[model samples]
Target: MPDQASPAPVSTAIPPHRGGLPDPRHFDPVIFPGAEAGEVWPPTHFNFHAPWMHEAGLGFERDASGGIAVVRSFAHLRLLVDIETAHQLFDLAPGSRDFRLLRLIPAALRCVERIIPGDPMPGPLLDEEEEVPEEHHLYAATTAMVERLAGQAGEEGQALAEAMRRVPPGPGMFEAAVARCITRFGFPMATVAPLARRLQRLANAHARVLATAAAQPDYAAMEKVVLRTRQPLGADRGWVGGGLLTRAMDGLLPQISRPRRASTAILAAAEEAMRRPLPLEAPTRLILEQDGYRDRLLDISVFWRRLSAAWMTVDPDTTDRREIEALARNTLRRLSLTSLYRAPDEP
Candidate 1:
């Protein structure tokens, strides 16, 4: 046999672990979806407008100082009735869920005429004539919708529908939507493809976690996905104990029958914990301290810890775990990827 080259030296080099997690820099850096190559996050431009508001018969008035005063509308009372019906039917969060569930608008309008009777909206949405407490209106609206839904699907089905609304119909919904936007709207594919891929990866990871949790409910595996999505590999510092994971667990407090004061305290502690610094190398810490970027560092740190705690301490058997997980995934969609490029704030 031809002389075989000497066996390649088995160089043994172990990856660094910071605070019990692998250095974030060692793995592929987590890119934010919809970001273009070389573009800085929190883009320089902030002047954006929603023409949809005008399309919906809403107009904004400017005050003496040229700031927006109030959103005024001369739309018919029928439109207001439809909106109120939709609000209750969907349990819409003010800005977030309202937009995501617009496809149900037509359904909401049809249901309104049947469920809420004739329009009486020449006055304000609130009514003091109703013999109830200050917050009774809120509950009354929600209760009416729930009762209607229960008639069709029963109470359990209504609950399941409510929980499922937090997420879209499928894992590919986001990617498909982006692809459609690019193709139909003439958006440049070159810039959007990378973002779509990143989002696809995130959606896949989330789906895997959900699938696995359905059967096994592995906290360690869930934590890995959360950390990988939130932080890059081989970074100077890594996530440690009880940070964002703790915060996410705090969100579950309302589901339990905890006292209001105790819930508030627990939430407060989670908020404080999220702001604590990550475990940094001694030299890196010294440099950051010397550079007067401590506050900026803290802000940047917030992004690194963003989704890491999402499923921590979660009970797989919790009645609303699916709902909470959907909400956590929605966070990635709603928030900007501001931490991808961490530059020190100007002093």
Candidate 2:
């Protein structure tokens, strides 16, 4: 007989105790639909959008047959099953996380769904609105597009659309409308993708510096500096922090009452830094101490604020629209992918 490979050695070891409960984080994959024995569910993309999803006791992975498996962790046990089974369980146990995840599906489907059929927009028309400046034209076009999309979404969409229409036209109104749309119909990725991308870039640029500051023992002092900027300096207050003597001391300090623009920039940088995940490393005290570091933070802060204001106003002429659109698209795509519904059939 041909030589046979030696049998693999098997070692016997006691599994670690998990506080009197089975470790939901690990399980035999054989029992799960389409999963091979001993496989663990791969992390899903949605986890990045909302890290709390994992904390809320839900997980996702693919089985050996390449089918998605939904894993629910509860009371220290994990139940792995097919999507349909998962949905049924969700229906029976409907929690806040379940509803939140469900909301993403309809919102994402709204994007690719062929509601109008044929052309989403018909041939050019000779209308007064067309005569408006390009910025106004694009803004109106995007707004109209959103209305049409919401109209096709049925009762819920219509209600949201109606609420949006009630808001007066302007950046503030648009901001309100966008907020309502997201809360009711999820994000309108097609419209807001550019802005989201810009925010992501801004977030990336400051992540390291912010992480460093966060790790320092005197980080709280930095926060106080950033927070104090929100209040404008006034003559009535003798001293900024305490009394007349302190005010005199502040006047003697060169950096005290820094230019409004500088303060604004720092505030903006702080806000953006708070929005995303930070890297893991020892704090670089030298980086925080450098004048160049402060300058860089200021520059980014100013740029981010302008970008944000433009977004709120829907300034069509702003060069940053591309980044905004990209951001929106990225967020929408992620939400769409991780949603509960299967991919919609291609038309």
Candidate 3:
């Protein structure tokens, strides 16, 4: 009989059932051998799972340091997904938003390997050439690519097609926009933490003030007067202006909030924001600021083959135990691998 080599080691795959409603695991667990254990669920790697299946046909694995790494590097072709697992934590402008925040996803892992050459983070692996947007060519280019993905027949192909349908409305849709940013210009979030935190605190305090303003009788009358101003209805001018005016309308809500019932709504939202804090740059003031870093892993070639197979094997997902625990270790090893990207001009 002809000699046969051992079957290649399988890798970890992001399964179909994305961690649902009440629980959104925004990161991938490194359920591989020798991975780390932490309170962090969904180690951001899984956030780009869709793009992996759709594009590279790969899985997850561990690095030299026993961290999680993607099997195949990201390609510029096919569905470009950017999982924005952290952006919602603040009131970031539509302009400066990072879109890679979802859970159970697979995205371009190259960015994680390319940090600037001299920087502390992973350099060559994450540093891609800067992308200059071609606003005029945007629509035509996006439509063409979206159609290509949508045209596929199988469920996997169809899923990518459907997601492409909901490309997020904006000057540059969400998924593609995220890729362009990270691949071309990676985000530096370590320093962004303090500003994000302070902003969050202010938002909480403002909510409290709003609650107080809501209860006062005089504030109601003042707000009524502002409504009659008959100003133009631009996005901000009308709604937010009215909101601001009403709050300051003799400060009824603020007054009512005395002994302030920071009503459960804002408080809950605030807590959620904190729990899923955006990956803002680590603050310089932080005791040991890990200022900037990439989102994925290095040498995913070894990591993914072992990971995807394992993920496909025992994924029961009971809250008591995530079936993908083995994969978590792979993710942990790469946590220190420095997720950076190669310059677009490289090869």
- Who wins the TM-score comparison? 1
Q: Write the residue-wise lDDT of candidate 3 on 201-263 in tens digits.
A: 333332332222221122122222223221221123324344443333223322322111222
Whole-model lDDT, candidate 3? 0.29
Which model is ahead, 1 or 2, in terms of lDDT?
Answer: 2
Alpha-carbon lDDT, every model:
0.31, 0.32, 0.29
TM-score, candidate 3, is 0.16
State every prediction's TM-score relative to the real structure: 0.20, 0.15, 0.16
Q: TM-score for model 1?
A: 0.20
Evaluated against the true structure, the overall lDDT of model 1 is: 0.31
Give the per-residue Cα lDDT of candidate 3 at 20: 21
Ranking by lDDT: 2, 1, 3
Q: Any idea how many clashes model 2 has?
A: 15
Candidate 3 contains a number of clashing pairs equal to 93
Best by lDDT: 2
